[model samples]
Target: MEKQNISVGLDIGTTKIVAMIGRKNEYGKVEILGVGKSKSLGVHRGVVNNITQTIQSIQQAVQEAEVTASEKIEDVTVGIAGQHIRSLQHSDYITRANSELVIDEDDIDQLINQVHKLVMLPGEEIIHVLPQEFKVDGQAEIKEPIGMYGGRLEANFHVVVGQVSSIRNIGRCVKSSGLELEGITLEPLASANAVLSQEEKEAGVALIDIGGGTTDLAVFKDGIIRHTAVIPFGGNVITEDIKEGCSIIEKQAELLKIKFGSAWPGENKDNEIVSIPGLRGRDPKEITLKNLSKIIHARVVEIIEQVYVEIKNYGHEEQKKKLIGGIVLTGGGSQLKHLKQLVEYITGMDTRIGYPNEHLAGDSDDDIASPLYATAVGLVMDGLKRQDRKAREAQEELQLEEESYDDTESVEEEQVLESEPKERKSFLDKLTERVKDFLDNAE
Candidate 1:
């Protein structure tokens, strides 16, 4: 008996590390096979700052997930984020090989490889190469070019890059915990995959992942990634603001944010106030609920406004007119009360909180379906996609090898014409057909 399907997702975030394993069930929906979570240490501002501590955290999370799933974990699709992550668009041109101008996988791969050679900063690495659109001889916006006849092929792509050192640190941490990295996907893209609908992405939308230390924004239009940015501030900043504003400790601030914070001041009642127990012999102070909401509202609005600035700087405003899907807010911070309203008010776009329930099993627990798990769930899906992709690539490579062998055999037969052999046409044809059938069946 061999393993059919199993996937794991490891999300290293500023506040916590989450590991989730999922597999397909009989009904075709993805079921939650395992879940693990641990308080993250050695991480700050969404990047791993201490490798050993992070490794311990990852090991614990993986162990918990393994026990829950009753399976051993080997590799994972890790999610990466931080302020240094960047995305840009580029295009490359390639001519068809083998004479006929038929665009094939080789041509597409060649164009992508060309873009990977594009220069970047001294310490950055290309994490993923995403094909945006293809064009044939000046015709714009072709999706799939394979099997199409064209004299020249060009492809526009969204290249995702990140700090080489930071990515290496993540890999080191995971590898230290005995797991190989299957792939590294940017956090915003992962969250977008988990939340955004194909129709919404095509219609134009910005996915805002409000994590502990950074707010990640992925702008999509025409169903392609237009831009991605990481704002250096998030829900944690708002909590700090509440603490400073009310003379409370950080832990108290976090508690208030979770218990009573609202994204908009108007959502708070006029007479509502939280009675806070004072320290030492000081008198207990009454903190107005409206004031708390106002503090939260100010920071959250500023974050949303910054997201707007980034979107505008990318010159995506015109696209927004028709990109009516508006903003999809996810992550732990997006759970703020009245956040959707605040985002809508500031960005003037229809807003909704996105959840990771798109592919969730109906019997799955409620905690697993929250927006905070968007990136985690998407990482698992990304792993599945990578496995399928690698399988296809392996088959293609073997097919190319077989074709090369056949070409060599033909050349040898032609050279040895003096010892001419019978054609054995039907027999050879039948063998070739059987080989094809074998490969097809194996797949």
Candidate 2:
């Protein structure tokens, strides 16, 4: 059977790896076909550390999703984030060959290619170069410089960088799982796309994705990503702190956090208590809800404060740089009770838990719309977009082939033209393959 218009998203999170299959419906909403989730092993803080186990986990998730969707899965879009990922803002200018020529997509591509050449610390590579704003001959703050005429094309970029070995490991795992990697989207950017609206991005907003092993921050202003940061701390630390503070097992600690965890100590009464069964056959232990809240509150505050510091570093305190949309939190960690209240109190910014329902079909499962699936949904959207791009390119190639056949009396010329568009892989996909080959050659 021919493959339908479906895109799959693979979110290799620290806590869970999810494979989500989806397609756009008639009403321009994303209809989720199926989803498969498995406990993530061999990955920590969003980076792959164990190839064999990671490939097993990925294959397991993909197989489950394929079974549910009743379709074969081949290419998948992956999400990337970790403590090692960092973003920097840089401004660059390009001297155009001709002053009379109008700016176009090629000009922008050339400028982006220039930014890609930036030197990085050893063992690191550029993952993304997002343009923030453009300037034409010092006429600054131009959002779109296309169609304008100028000798110098300049722009500010938000460049994301990561460890090459870590990224290569992820690529290797995906390939070993018998799946082709279509693309990789920054986890923060993916979640932001799923949750934040265009208006929020235009007015300025901060998106905080509190995942299992890391907290990702993406600050947007004037509809462009202005800054991005990844904090090493996340929900896992809170669970660990609870485990140590309460002298309980990791499983019980995670359950307690999910079931009754509160980020506001004042909201929980001291008399309210929950009992945890002892390991094996020991006596059950009783803990006050108030104490649990205190532990959660402490760690949640630490994370919010760190994110606040990053926001301030982005010049949010400045009158002109204020984030009018305040903050929108997502990810599995963001589901903690009273976390939004605590964040608002700490940052003095309006805060809300972001859900991925904005672009979902009306009949989508309620659980699928939760913040936990925000990155997965966004990756699916990105995959669909890439699929559309590929379709368009194919159609254009067909048209060119037909035109070539008409213009050329020789049949050999048409065959040559048809074979020319094979090198249409994504640049990052090529990079991943190149790095994989490099590693194999060293071995």
Clashes found in each candidate (C-alpha, N, C closer than 3 A) = 0, 0
Q: Candidate 2 regions off by >4 Å?
A: 1-4, 405-443
Query: What are the lDDT figures for the candidates, one per model?
Result: 0.81, 0.89
lDDT of 1 by residue, 100-163 (tens): 6566666776787788789999988676677877888788878877778888898877777778
Once model 1 is optimally superposed onto the true structure by TM-score, how far is the C-alpha of residue 415 displaced, in angstroms?
Answer: 24
Worst 10 residues of 1 by lDDT: 419-428
C-alpha RMSD for every candidate: 9.6, 3.8
After superposing candidate 1, which stretches have Cα over 4 Å from the reference?
1-4, 94-100, 280-282, 319-321, 390-443
Candidate 1 TM-score, true structure as reference: 0.84
Best by TM-score: 2
